[model samples]
Target: MKTLYDVQQLLKKFGIYVYVGKRIWDIEVMALELDHLYKAKIISNKEFVSAKLVLTHEHKIEELKIKKLNNGGGL
Candidate 1:
């Protein structure tokens, strides 16, 4: 289990990252990160593609945000 601090430390490495949380506990933080990236226009379609691939390979959960992208939209 990643403590909030651990997650924060990982996020600090880059302005953005693919967040993998065990549950909804980190949704707000992840949303804020994505929000910052979106506001800065740093999230490109290609980055989304890459992030999705990484998330799928690294995570096994179905409730996270990345899984939401598999619902037919081409993120």
Candidate 2:
């Protein structure tokens, strides 16, 4: 859960594949799936927290990139 790829692999283990054609959208969907898994007690607290940290970090990075692109700096 150190990277987005790790988070994706975790989700994939449960047959959850998310690709909404946009990085932000995909991360959002993955968050939802993670929430569901956590609620179902399918994942441990440590795994949930680690995955969330990864997702949140990645989401922020994507948001920053979008902001930069809109501001004319671009990625």
Candidate 3:
């Protein structure tokens, strides 16, 4: 998918909804779910790779924001 929202929408189409009270946790859960779907052949390799990349990128961005905030940079 092009963005995290797009990946979430794709998961929604499969009746998957995940939340763990934290954004990073939620993204991790989504990644796990995507892996399962890929293994089960429910999604194509291209779709899985695309979604994974989006998730990873978003996760990194979130982490960087947290780091910046922790470093007293007001994000």
For model 2, how does the per-residue alpha-carbon lDDT over 1-75 read when each residue is reduced to its tens digit?
699999999999999999999999999999999999999999999999999999999999999999898898933
Query: Which tens-of-lDDT digit does each residue in 1-75 have in candidate 1?
Result: 134444444456675454555444354545457456656776665554444343443344535455677775575
Clashes of 1: 0
Model 1 error, position 50 (Å)? 8.5
RMSD of 3: 1.5
RMSD in angstroms, all models? 10.5, 1.7, 1.5
Per-residue lDDT of model 3, residues 15-43, tens digit only: 99998898988999999999999999999
- Assess candidate 3 and give its lDDT: 0.94
Q: Which pairs of residues collide in candidate 1?
A: none
- Stretches of candidate 1 above 4 Å error? 1-22, 46-75
- Output the worst ten-in-a-row residue range by lDDT, candidate 3: 66-75
TM for every model, in the order presented, reads 0.33, 0.94, 0.91
The runs of at least 3 residues in candidate 3 whose Cα sits more than 4 Å from the true structure, single-residue gaps closed, are none
